[model samples]
Target: MASTLNTQLHSISFAAFILQEIMGNPREDETPQSRLKQVGMMSVLYIMHQGHQPLTISNLVEITKLTRMGVSEVIEPLIARGMLTETFVKNSMGRGKARQFAISEEIFEKLQSFQMR
Candidate 1:
């Protein structure tokens, strides 16, 4: 299974693997065209950022070069699936809190297995 995932992940982008293998189908309103765009953005984020650190939406935007809305679109579904976890980070300077995102332990373990292939 891990080898298969590795091959598939290399053949398609990692985001496609995550979307199809883990998250299931795209939303009803989403088209293949739109999903492709999001997949590209997701690939950028996954490739460019190491998951060891939790990242903010701004961090994801910077890493993926997507707008806030675009990042939200990609992230929300993962969060909904329990594949990603989000935490609130309060600003010491009295600014509003920021949400930080990280892969869930179960998903992270699965991803690590794929990487080991």
Candidate 2:
């Protein structure tokens, strides 16, 4: 019971920290698109933090209920920021390979330290 509660608390705080970093300073000219982007980024980060396995874009789209394009948009930025790492999955039965994403090791370590606070 205690372990479950601690895990829940860590997840919640981890999500909050991600939101704070993504939201940064609010501007007077915030628009619907900007807000949606922020939420999408946060959702991706939160999911990556909680999941032990790397995920494909299709998996993220299904989990977050975001469109394929929306997930792609957020994921690119996360990758560029060094917050996420992308690895290719070989498709033995298919023509093309799929990319898998996971939280970067540095960021994951930081998250663990943050949760301890």
Candidate 3:
């Protein structure tokens, strides 16, 4: 129906608006390095926000379709900048270690305030 088409159009428009805001608007606190890292880290966080659990480098590689090295390159800086946090745990098999990555409260708050314009 016309109403359904209208609703679908509105949804697409809103998605485009959010993408534009994310790509175009930089917060005053964001540095050039942070901005670059944000592109990758935000993709990671958006995945987590969508109910994915136990976020790890491996999971990020799978979700983002990037190589492990590529994901690590993105994650290391985010960790250093305190925009993301990592926790280590013993593997279930007790044969190795695993790391879980999550967005920091500060970054989450700042991201929440980004205008959707």
Candidate 4:
């Protein structure tokens, strides 16, 4: 019972932290498109954050319900921010497939701090 409660609490707090980061008090000049982009990126980060596998754009699109273009817009900026990095790998057919992305260690550490506070 205690373990279940702890798990639920952790989930709630983590979701709140993610929301606070992505939806941070909206700015006066922030446009709907810009806000959507931010939310899209945060949704990708939150899903890919499990650290199980380097997730591909298709995976994020399917999970987050965002269009390919939308994911592309946000992912590029996240990479620029150094919070995410990609690794390209060829498939069995030796064709260049979409790259996979993982949260940088620095970003993961920052998330840990959010968990703490």
Candidate 2 TM-score over all chains jointly = 0.70
Q: Best TM-score goes to which candidate?
A: 2
Ranked candidates (TM-score, high to low) = 2, 4, 1, 3
Candidate 3 has its poorest 10 consecutive residues by lDDT at: 108-117
Task: Write down the TM-score for model 4.
Answer: 0.61
lDDT digits (tens) for residues 13-60 of candidate 1: 456566674435766766676666555645554554444544678777
What's the TM-score of each model vs. the native?
0.59, 0.70, 0.57, 0.61
lDDT values for all models: 0.65, 0.69, 0.64, 0.66
Off by over 4 Å in 4: 1-6, 22-32, 51-54, 64-67, 92-94
Look at candidate 3 and tell me the lDDT of residue 3: 79
Q: What is the lDDT of residue 21 in candidate 3?
A: 49
What would the per-residue lDDT of candidate 4 be over residues 27-108, giving only the tens digit for each residue?
5655667756765565556656654644777777787788988678777755765657888876435776767777677755
Error of 1 at 7 (Å): 14
lDDT of 3 by residue, 31-100 (tens): 6665566565665565575475767877777788989887787777657656568999776577899887
Comparing 1 and 4 on lDDT, the stronger one: 4
- Clashes by residue pair, model 3: none
